[model samples]
Target: MMARPPLPLWLQDNLTLRLQDGLLSLPTSSNNSDDKNSSLTTTYNLISKRHVISSLVIPLLRHMRLKKEMSMRSKQNA
Candidate 1:
C-alpha cells in the first residue's frame, strides 16, 4: 500500500475552502414548490447571512475545486 502524494499548498488550501463552502451551503432549499407563499418566503430567506454566504461561496468554491483537481491529477500523472 502507498500513501498519496500531498497536494500542493495552493491546491490544499483550495480544497479546504471548498469543504468550508459545502458546509456553508446547507441552509437553503432549492425545491420549486408551486405554493406562491413558500416561494415568497424563500426569497426573503435569501437575505439571511447563511443564504448570502452559500450563494456567494458555493459556485466559486466548486470552480476552484475543479481547477485544483485537474492540476493535482496532472501532477500525479507526470
Candidate 2:
C-alpha cells in the first residue's frame, strides 16, 4: 500500500486561512477601495488585521476549542 503524502504546514495553514477568508471576500469586494482619498487604510490597521484575525486566527481557535471540548466530553463519558 502506498502511503499518502502529508500536506506541508504552510499549505495547510494557507488553505485553512483561505477557507475562512473566502467567507468574507464577497462582502468586502463590493465596497473595495482603490480611490485616491481612501482613509480606511491610511488611518488604521483594521483592514488587514480583520482578514487575518477572522480568516486565520479565529477559525483555528474555534477548531482547537471544539476539539478540546469533544475530547474532554469523550473522556468524561468513558
TM-score of every candidate: 0.35, 0.47
Model 2, 1-77: lDDT tens digits are 99998765865877666667553343322254566544644433455557667766777788879999999999999
Model 2 stretches with alpha carbons more than 4 Å out: 1-12, 15-45
Model 1 TM: 0.35
Predict model 1's lDDT versus the native. Answer: 0.64
In terms of TM-score, the best-performing candidate is 2
For candidate 1, write residues 22-71 as lDDT tens digits.
53243456566765677756655555545546654576688789999999
Clashes of each: 0, 0
